[model samples]
Each structure stands twice: as structure tokens, then as C-alpha cells.
Target: MERNAVEERVAQHYAGGIYAPDRAPEDMAIQSDTLFMFLMGEAGQREDMEAWMVRMAEAMDRIQELMDVLEARAEEKEESGAA
Candidate 1:
């Protein structure tokens, strides 16, 4: 799917509460750490590890971008409320 489509899908999912915003940062941090550990552990066992890592890195970058957008929006809301 295209990037915009993927983003839309994720937004819809988030709006539906498929993922809770309050715990998202901690959950994502733990999940990322787990994925890294698993990838590293499998690196010695898999011949295609390099290709897999490259794909995962690209996906992670996209996820990070989405998180940054969400964080900025949240901060804006907080700031507006404070003001």
C-alpha cells in the first residue's frame, strides 16, 4: 500500500482505540527494544538477517515519523489548554 493509505489506516485504527495513547510511548519503547534484541539474537542464526534488518529499519523510521507527528499534536493541545 501507499504511504498515505498506510497512514490513514493507522489513524483510523488509533481513533478506534486499537492502541491506547496513554501507554503508547512506553509500549512502543518496550516493543522496539524487544524487536532489536530478537533481531540481534537471530542475526547469528539467519543468513538473510541483513535484508530483514534493512526492511525493519525502514518500517521503524516510518513509525517514528508517525509518533513524532502524534507527539507534536499532543503537545500543541497541552499548550493550548495551558494558555
Candidate 2:
């Protein structure tokens, strides 16, 4: 599936590293508060885990794709006697 605008923005924001965003302190605090609330007990019940599970599977697939690209580059370099 194609990435949405929000996903693209987030990926661009974090591509450098896990550094904090350039948002205002108030926005940051609000996000932290919402996350804390979700972590406490507002997230969901055990039966509502399918979405999270699918997200994990998708993450693994992305990792595999990245590995495949790296492996292909390695093979190409080896064939060319780069090192």
C-alpha cells in the first residue's frame, strides 16, 4: 500500500534518527500526556490486538526488504572485487 501524507511526514521527520521533533513544548507535553493515558489503561482490551499485531508483521516485512537490498548490494560489490 502507498504511504499516506501523515506517514510520509513522520518518516521524513524520523529518518535522521530518534531525535525530538521541532514542535512547541506545549505540543510535546500534550503528546506525552496522551501517550501516558493510553499506556495506563485507555489503550484497549486484549481482544483488540489484531491491529498492533499486523503492524508488527509489517515492520518485520520492511526490515526484510531492507536486508534484501543490502544483500544484493553486497553481492554486486563482491562480483566487482570492491573489497
Clashing residue pair totals per candidate (backbone < 3 A): 0, 0
What tens digits encode model 2's per-residue C-alpha lDDT throughout 34-83? 43323212222223445544554776798899999999999999999997
- The candidate that wins on TM-score is 2
lDDT of 2 at 23: 40
| Candidate 1: regions farther than 4 A off | 1-47
Q: Over the full model, what C-alpha lDDT does candidate 1 score relative to the true structure?
A: 0.51
Q: Give TM-scores for every candidate, taking all chains together and pairing residue i with residue i.
A: 0.42, 0.43
The C-alpha stretches of model 2 lying farther than 4 A from their native spots are 1-47
Cα displacement (angstroms), candidate 2, residue 24, comes to 27
Best prediction by lDDT: 1
